[model samples]
Target: MPAPNAWVLTEGHAGMESQAVGLAEALGLTPEPRRLRARLPWDWLPGRLWPVPLMGVTTEQGPLAPPWPGVAISCGNVSAPVCAALRRRGVKAVHVQHPKMDPAAFDAVVAAVHDGITGPNVIVTRNALHRATPERLAAARAEWMPRFAHLPRPLVAVLVGGTNGRFRLDGEVGADVAERLAGMMERDKVGLYVTPSRRTGEDAKRALADRLVPLGAEIWDMQGENPYFGLLACADAIVVTCDSVSMMSEAVASSVPVFILDLPGKSRRIGEFIDMLVRDGRVRRFDGRLETWPVTPLDDTPAAAAEVKRRLGL
Candidate 1:
């Protein structure tokens, strides 16, 4: 028999939702994405009130609880209170990524080793888990290959991300990176598949299009229909900015070698994580070389799922 329904919650963020979906797939569980509602009066206090809307608004009718699933898996800070509510009703709660609060609140916490969170209930991984199955990769290749069929022989994938309050992804930086990549493309007659994240700045997107798109590259803004996975699957090599660990993790999951763009003043956690990966020979920094190295895949989703199942005896 199939596993019981799992409720997955995200605050409308693609990355968090993607991770929840990936974990559900890895665990062979059916996940139903549910919108969460806030239950606290403090949730409506001014600028702090963002969570009220992000987590659906509470009503005079009652506490708007969605259908209770056998399990609840959540990502990001917004899901904490919602997960707690589910737990109160004896629902199993599994949280992916550091809770940004206490780990003890969740039944199991799946965190990145670089997150510096260690606990009995915590499962640390080198990178975030993703669902990059061979079937998905094959499908992506089939869909994207024809678009770049006439561009060039070798293709380079540039995955762009924007600032996350702690960092800045400026147009000048994108131009600089694009220039360096364009130089490499010129020498190798390379094709380019560039995709920007939702956080990616408008100026950066424009800069990339103005500087790199005309050089036989296909640029995908948020409006573009192509899936980012297709770019990762079809590229000879990937160039990712140092802002997103999830993006880096997905790139490493691909068979191709990944090169991270330089971010001088980014978080120390990112630096430490990159250092560990480099020392372990999993990924390389962008230094004008396309080389492949064997990577020890550290997929935590299955392990986490197994542990959860074992705990629940399901």
Candidate 2:
């Protein structure tokens, strides 16, 4: 018999993995994260085209043998096949993003509206799921407060995402961001908490530091401990780069106001998501102004998880 709980499938990307884990937690399930490993052309194949046996994994990776699980939450295109394989064994699969195949393959397909995936089973979410909750936020605040307390009040946390296919965080854009932020620091007298994503190359990182550090902003040197969660918990306002939906979702999910910084290119899905938040008054574009306003946090994880439970009858 399969396990009585839920399993989260991923290829090990942090953002994608977090969504699966987030949804699982919202469902009140302890997520058993399973990383999928494959090789060759088979590895590149879409879930629908994947062979029965799949690909390779070390013995230490655990037995994928029988008894998959009661429910499986999968993120990313590669993990779709793992979910599909489990579906063959009576596992209900909740897939995030366009499965890059038939929507009918899964019990429920959760996608962002911009993905243009529609079906009877498809549920659209304004943003990607995340593990931002009141409890987590409280813990983060408690743990991170004393460390950041010395910084001034009205903290502005800047979450910088690197480049995606549509847009790149090149030196030019980085300079523009630095200049704008320097202006904000000079005029607003607010302290900054800055952290760069992996996609944020050294050039962009240096650019931001050169401008923000001297102004008394606390920028993570990518060493020791990361203050990401603490910053989110403690920030009075948040500024996020537009290339990532996950970052924006986490920001707006906090009670603080979110300022979205526009990148050079465009992403239909990300754009639509941001527009929705803007209309809802949860977010605004960064215009060299740091403003704090009250609005309900944008939370979709719980509802999405509830839908999964109802559909799976768990």
Candidate 3:
């Protein structure tokens, strides 16, 4: 059972929530997730610079009142001040990702190596924290294996991400990606399962679905429970779009061979991260081939959690 003694703070963003929840679970804490929203001018300003942190936080669920937890795991710059405020009140606060401010404010700042931020209080990791535990994988495998039994062996999981500030995955690009993945499935006789993020625009998903689904690929249309964990558990190879560091981090953290699908536009920072993995032989670029290779997972969730424990003596 998870201990209910921690709070996972975010601005209600999926990526931020995942990282914060991942850390809290790693700490054996069943956290109360709170989304901090700042109204008016406060929302436009930097959370790190807030004079009164609590003043900026308001939750639709309830007011940001007291009875705070012993631990606060925060992600997202918007909600960072709330974590700092909790820390000042004697709660141990840990921030995931770069806080975009001084790292010394939190008990520990969990950052990625690519971010290039470092301090005594910083815990640098090769990948982002996620909620992909071994036990969860085992359970997913047990639950989903039967459902996917008819799909055949060598199942490939394709994670499709859409447009972001840096990259674009429009219909044309989506078709191109779909064509390549479909080629892999047809050529390799692999069962292809594709999942798209909310960022995956409808047109992009349609493009992918139109092409890949006809080739016996299973693409989740964002209905029912997200089969993401199931795909992770059952995949022999994982192909993920390069728009998100968090998504790539989760895939790269797995022992399965990972293939990075390229998108339009250049993101040099994320490119550097991909290059690091490529140099290490842990990942390769997707080019219509289902090539297999030995992969040793490079996970940092436990390490970050351990740092939290070490810092807070929890």
Whose lDDT is greatest here? 3
Pairs that clash in candidate 3: none
How well does model 3 score by local distance difference test? 0.87
> Model 2, range 77-135, lDDT digits (tens) per residue?
77887787678778888898888888787899888777789999988887788999889
List the candidate 1 regions with Cα displacement exceeding 4 Å: 1-3, 35-41, 44-63, 292-298
Ranking by lDDT: 3, 2, 1
lDDT of 2: 0.83
Better of 1 and 2 by lDDT: 2
Tens digits of per-residue lDDT, candidate 1, 1-314, equal: 97667878766576787788788777778877764445566545432234433344443434446566778888877676566557767888888887776778778888888888998888787778677756687889999778767766567788888878556778887677778777777776777788889888888788888887778788875674756878877887888888887788788777777888875466888788778777877788887555566655435656766776676566
lDDT tens readout by residue for model 3, 1-314: 64767888888877778888988889889878888888777777788778888887788777677787888988988777788888889889899988887777789999889988899999998888898888888899899888888886799999888898999999999889988988888888999999999889999999989998887888897989898988888889999999988888888777799999999988878999999999999899999888998889878899888977888898
How displaced is residue 178 in candidate 1, in Å?
A: 1.7
Error of 2 at 197 (Å): 1.7
Q: How many backbone clashes does candidate 2 have?
A: 0
Give residue 10's lDDT in candidate 3 (0 to 100): 89
Alpha carbon lDDT of each predicted model: 0.74, 0.83, 0.87
Those runs of model 2 whose alpha carbons end farther than 4 Å from true positions after fitting are: 1-5, 56-63
